[model samples]
Target: MKVFGICGYSGSGKTTLLEAMIALLTARGLKVSLIKHAHHGFDIDKPGKDSWRHREAGAGEIALITDKRWVLMHEARNEEPPQLVDILERLSPCDLVLLEGFKRAVHPKIEVHRPSLGKPPVWPEDCDIVAVASDQAIDCALPRLDLNDPEQVADFVLKHVGLK
Candidate 1:
């Protein structure tokens, strides 16, 4: 499957852009999957849920199933978090995979930037960043895209990945 990444500092609207891009991409008939990296500890299961109880009972992996969807939760315990390649291998076939984090990975990425955030851009230091999407125009060597325009951003992404 083709892989692309959207990366930026916290509060830079990375998720918002991804949400819009996904809708646009899927509307065009491409199958898309996503893998997001969380910097802090996070839990998707509730304390009183069966999955949570199973995990609390020392189950290393819990697979929760319903008519609508299924989710597999694996506890890291003493093991380190899985790398990008390892996770990619587990995903089913798809036209594209949009990564929400994993900025250090070598995959091509668009650096979502917001000048109001007061954070330095990541493109200068990261060769993997092929373009910059910002709320306000800034001087940069790579192509600059309007952060608020999802259609234009999606077009850039599809063309960059050869999906257009």
Candidate 2:
């Protein structure tokens, strides 16, 4: 699959942009999958849920299935978190994979930036950042995308990833 990433500091609208891009890409009949990296401890299962109970009972992995969907949850235990490439290999085939976060990964990424957030841009230090999407003008040599214009941003992304 063609892989791309959307990276930014906290509260910089990375999720918002990804939502828009997903809609646009899917509308074009492209099969897209996403892998999001979380910096904090998170859980999709509640304490009383069967999957949670199974995991608590020393089950290393659990697969929960319903008519609509299925999810596989694995415990990391003492092992280090899986690398990006390892996770990618586990995913089913797709035309594109949009990654949210994984700022330190060496994948091509678009840095979502907001000047009002008062956070420094990551592109200056991340050579994999191919473009910048910001609400306001910023000083940079990379291509600037209007954060409010999803179509424009999508165009740039498609072109950059050779999907256009």
Best by lDDT: 1
Cα lDDT tens digits, model 1, 1-164, are: 99999999999999999999999999999999999999999999999888899899999999988999999999999999999999999999999999998999999999999989899999999999999999998999999999999999999989989999
TM-score of 1: 0.98
TM-score of each: 0.98, 0.98
Question: Which portions of model 1 miss their true places by more than 4 Å?
Answer: none
Please state every model's RMSD to the true fold in angstroms: 0.8, 0.7
Backbone clashes under 3 angstroms, per model: 0, 0
Q: lDDT of all the models against the reference?
A: 0.95, 0.93
Model 2 Cα shift for residue 107 (angstroms):
1.0
> What does candidate 2's lDDT look like per residue over 1-164, in tens digits?
99999999999999999999899999999999999999899999999988899999999999999999999998999999999999999999999999999999998999999989888889999999999999998999999999999889888988988999
